[model samples]
Target: MPLVAPVTVHKISGETLTEVPDLLAVEEPLEIRLGFGPITDRQQRSVSVTMRTPGHDEELAIGFLFSESIVQKPTDIISCRHCVQDSQKEGNVLRVELHPDVVMDWSRLERNTFTSSSCGLCGKTTIDAVMALTPGPLSADFSIEPAVLHALPERVRQTQRAFAYTGGIHAAALFDVDGKLLLVREDIGRHNALDKLIGAAFWQNWLPLSQFGVFLSGRIGVELVQKSWRAGVPMLAAVGAPSSLAVQMAKEAQMTLAGFVRDNRFNLYSEPDRVIIGQVMAFKA
Candidate 1:
């Protein structure tokens, strides 16, 4: 069993003592470095230094790059490797070398400090600052039923392995057009879970997930919507409600956004045309 170092409190009663475990919050620092070689006159930029869990650092880096729109194609990334300048110390820094022909949009590169789950949009300076770096609209034309959206929560709940253990993690899952779960990742932070999932897809060379849909175990926020947009996900569903800004961004990005999905009931916030209401269970009933 995977173990999380949880803080415990002990209480002594009149007869016996009791111990209770608290949420385990671990902080590990990871550095991200961009490499394009010295020949192209492109300087290696240290983009972000985030405090996160030690596991899945590479995937986190790749997902962060994709979400930031730094690289489009998987081929654009030559390699992602861990570097340790000294033998005695364990380095959490990742050096990502891009293809010689690939060029990064440095003007849009933001988020210079630490990113916490509580606030995924803090480093963003302005709306234009974020919109300027986002990728184009999704290419998929599939539709999902409101009933299917409603059934997502049950499916996600059953598939949460880490949550079952620690009861303190969030998850992001990829579902096919048929509503079958494809991939799921859990992390202490909702954004981290999505990052891990997107990073896994990029590692498999599965660029542009417009054909598939993304489901979140939490509320739909602007940052999450932007990440899905950058990944080319045509439709995004969430168990909780979506923020007003998230709904606006989804509509602007031409992506289907659904929320309040739970117990076979959900509301279509934007692009209802992508949702086949007639195909949903609620309509059939």
Candidate 2:
């Protein structure tokens, strides 16, 4: 079966009602687990279960672990696989085996890692809770012209294969300064899409993505900004407006942030100096 599910929908326009077949982005829960041993004894524990699209389960799980600061490097993970523990499994549980030498911090695991469609460092008191996980500043050398920023939305739209089919998924793409699409991932959860992208990069030894910029098909949220910052991405552009917290993180991290990038127009929320306006032609939309 395709990752996207086809369903019948009733459309009501003016006074006429018609039933039509429509595609929906599939949503399912994936349980991420950790397994490790001390040469003689073995251990297994469940980390988190998040609602996400069906594909890229390993990438999603690894990305979640890295984003949440559970693990920093790709080598920290020994391997990943599907595990069935109970009747509810249905191939939805994933087990990530860490290097035996690595010590998993139970305290750092936090209270809970379960995330719904909308997830982040929740139940923690203040913004500082999120800021505590913030990564260091990114390199200031990599840059793109303001004109290129304006062209990104359309360029990214050209590669949204899943969104075209379902019209119900969010995409997160990585692009070079010249506006070339490096990678893109789509998911029902916007954050999950980004996680998959970052996790793929992590597995490919593509960390410290200092020269790359991220483009999101949805509004910029706090967790999205935090995740991008943690991954060392210097620039982030979103199709919709950014939340106040997202903007605040951008400023503190000194990362370039843009939003509402449509019709050749965009709003630079932070680190505006990073974009070189003189290099390309920029027209207001």
Specify the highest-TM-score model's number.
2
State TM-scores per candidate.
Answer: 0.81, 0.89
Q: Write the per-residue lDDT of candidate 1 for residues 1-285, one digit (tens) a residue.
A: 132556787878998999987655455567889998546476687887776655677788889888787777688788898888565425668888887787666655644222443555533343445566665656587786566677778888899866765677788999987789998887777777788789888888886887899999999877788788778888999888898778877887788988877877777877778887655454553
Model 1 scores a C-alpha lDDT of: 0.76
After superposition, the stretches of candidate 1 with alpha carbons farther than 4 Å from their true spots are 1-3, 10-17, 21-25, 39-43, 85-91, 111-131, 279-285
Candidate 2 lDDT score relative to the true structure: 0.83
List, residue by residue over 133-229, the lDDT tens digit for candidate 2. 6555666588888778888888877888778898788999999988889999888998999999999999998987888999999999777887888
Query: In model 2, what are the clashing residue pairs, if there are any?
Result: none
